[model samples]
Target: MRTFNMHEAKTNLSKLIDETVNGGQPFVIAKAGKPLVKVVRIETEAEKPRRRIGFMKGQLKVPADFDTMGADEIADMFEGKSK
Candidate 1:
């Protein structure tokens, strides 16, 4: 782990973050020669929650007129012709 003074860390924040993320090593930031904080990559793809597409596939049914099912009612409401 490399230690960076507060000034250095603030000056090259982007580069330091890149190195820490790519190299998989945590770096420390120090203030007045004392460690203040450590920066590390927290989550990788495997550690992140994945979005499961179609998780409920086949569990629900769609009617043939699904798209136009409410077309008339919505149009009537929009045109101030609701019953």
Candidate 2:
């Protein structure tokens, strides 16, 4: 942890932010020798909400021959056959 005075923090805000995010070092900003705020990286992705996979599970049905269902038609089109 490091503490930066108001003027210094303002001047090096970008660099301080980079260090906080990339180096995982948090810092504090002070005004008139009193702490005003702390700069830290937000929670990582693992701590944030994630998409719910398989939310539609059981709402759709798949045929046993799903993979080959359109095989014949696709082959016919490629062979210039119509019907």
Candidate 3:
């Protein structure tokens, strides 16, 4: 990662972008001597999708007839037509 102060970052944005895109490195731009925002390369479509394995295990249960709802029963819930 490379760090750039606000002035240099604003004045040389084009070079910064080129470096970010071609070099595939992240950068941080700071202002008032304080660390600020960051820029990084984006994942391409061919990249593997990120998954959280077993993140939801045993957290949810299947509901029987979950897809089956009468028209009036569904509409009444949305339109407050059911008591």
Candidate 2 CA-lDDT value: 0.92
Query: How many residue pairs collide in each prediction?
Result: 0, 0, 0
lDDT of 1 by residue, 1-83 (tens): 89999999999999999987886589999999999998998784666778999999999999999989989999999999959
Q: What are the runs in model 1 whose C-alpha is more than 4 Å off?
A: 46-83
* Distance from true location, Cα of 11 in model 3, Å: 0.6
lDDT of 1 at 38: 89
Error of 3 at 58 (Å): 56
lDDT of each: 0.91, 0.92, 0.85
Query: Alpha carbon lDDT of residue 34, candidate 1?
Result: 100
Using Cα atoms with residue i matched to residue i, what is each candidate's TM-score against the true structure?
0.53, 0.53, 0.50
lDDT of 2 by residue, 1-83 (tens): 79999999999999999888896689999999999998989876566767999999999999999999999999999999999
Query: Judged by TM-score relative to the true structure, which candidate is superior, 2 or 3?
Result: 2
